[model samples]
Target: MAATGLTPSKAGPSRPSAPREAAPAPPGGAFARALRRNLTAHAFLIGAVLCFAVFSWYPMVREFFLAFQTTENGEVSWVGLDNLATVFNDPAFWQAWRNTLLFTVLALLLGFAVPFLVAIVINEFHHAQGYLRLLVYLPVMLPPVASVLLFQYLYDPGYGLLNELLRLLHLPEQQWLQDPDLSMLSIVVASTWMNMGGATLIYLAALQGIPGELYEAAELDGAGLLRKIWHVTIPQTRLVLSLMLLMQVIATMQVFVEPFLLTGGAGPEGSTTTVVYLIYQYAFNFNDYGAAAALGLLLLVLLAGFSAAYVRLSRAQDE
Candidate 1:
């Protein structure tokens, strides 16, 4: 028998394998990821800042400097308060203010009230709401110049649709844009027609947001339409109304286009001459940029003060 050399050897302990090391991260990887994530937002912000700097901030700074400086033949010199003094002393200054105030009042009466009323009326109708909204907003979509021109034709004393309607109804045909007494009113009417669409839509949105349960509760309380509106609707939309009122006042005070196109920047007997029109006159017609800037500074100050006060009051009310 062959003895097999198969003696079992004593087994030694096996060595453990070495642990693998992770790959190192790329340099600045976190920073690159963050930059890429916000790149679009940063781009939009930068563009907005640049636009404001160029068109708003730069112009404002230039206007402030120009207000205190005068230009003569090509040379510029500081004039302290002379430009402001000149603006104050101008004969047309008070008249322009008076006209602007009047326009503001008239615009508020028509522009503010009409849109709210229109919104209310439209909101009451459940059917054809889209059609009504589109019809109301059509004028807003039109070019401002075209709308003004259309109104201009409608205001012509002869051969105008409005006057023709008056004739048909045996009413006196009015000189809508020619007569001093009626010129401002006519302008207000046209402005209301052209601009009320936006306000109406805003009011409509606010109205729609009001809870239907409130109206139902009012109805249960034996409230009529007017009572329901006064109690439920008005209270619900008060904030919107306040905001729109402030905006309306600011916008009306700065009105230029309506009066400008309607009455050639000044109505009969300078009736429709607004502060903005006066500013235009100073800068362009009379070539008095200093006075224009001074006047603009005054307006800016006034509007800023008014806005600040309004915001403070609103905050107080909220509190």
Candidate 2:
């Protein structure tokens, strides 16, 4: 007998599976078992959704239904577009609409552009960035009442600090808050001061995220500062800018508090009568919930159009 270089094997040539990749080890002790409990997770998620439906969606749907219904003495009745007809027919509605448009446009020009430019400037400056940020954000921490009251004093017709400063610098002492023509402008200025801080912070974050290398390369290729910003920074963060613009338009379109607090709902000659103020008047002063809800729906439709446009733009960019 002779021993050969062979080993014992099962019949049929010992076929075996190519090394079975280790089964992803079942997650591990208690944590793994808990995670696999889909019933618990699904139950919790459905409960959360139901809560939202009850609290948010139900209220919104109710508002929609009420928009087409009339109420008298705390009782509601179906009116079928009478509220819409009334809203369109009312003279005040046009005025409110005009004021809302004006506020939105002015705010974008005065508020949005300033913060964006300031963000760009701050991103460039090596010194005072933190100091300037803190200084700008300080207004945000101030209560709106305190801030408005402070502005009232500053815009006072007599012995105001700003008037004195204007006097000292040889600038005309304009009646800021009192004049009907100047009242909306005054509110815009105040709101801009308060609102610009957060916007500036968002833009600054976006600006900082832009790679310095892009600018360096652009400069190396003889591109100037404006060109670099136009070509590089603008394109790089256009999404954030568009998002902020939409938000600012929506927010500024609903300007109410500043005008209400500053000018007592409507300024001299109804100059600062914004849409939101009008809605508040309908809902509270006149007890016309239907009209208020109708106006709200109008705003929702307009802003929804803007949001839909944004979604399309985002999707186009992704593609």
Candidate 1 RMSD to the real structure: 6.1
Top-scoring candidate (lDDT): 1
For model 1, residues 127-207, the per-residue Cα lDDT tens digits are 988999999999999999999989988998999989999999999999999999999999999999999999999999999
For model 2, how does the per-residue alpha-carbon lDDT over 75-140 read when each residue is reduced to its tens digit? 879999988898899888999888789888888889989998889988888888999898878899
The TM-score values for the models, in the order shown, are 0.90, 0.81
Summed backbone clashes in each candidate are 0, 0
What is the lDDT, from 0 to 100, of the residue 260 in candidate 1? 93
Which stretches in model 1 have alpha-carbon errors above 4 Å? 1-33
Candidate lDDT values, in order: 0.93, 0.87
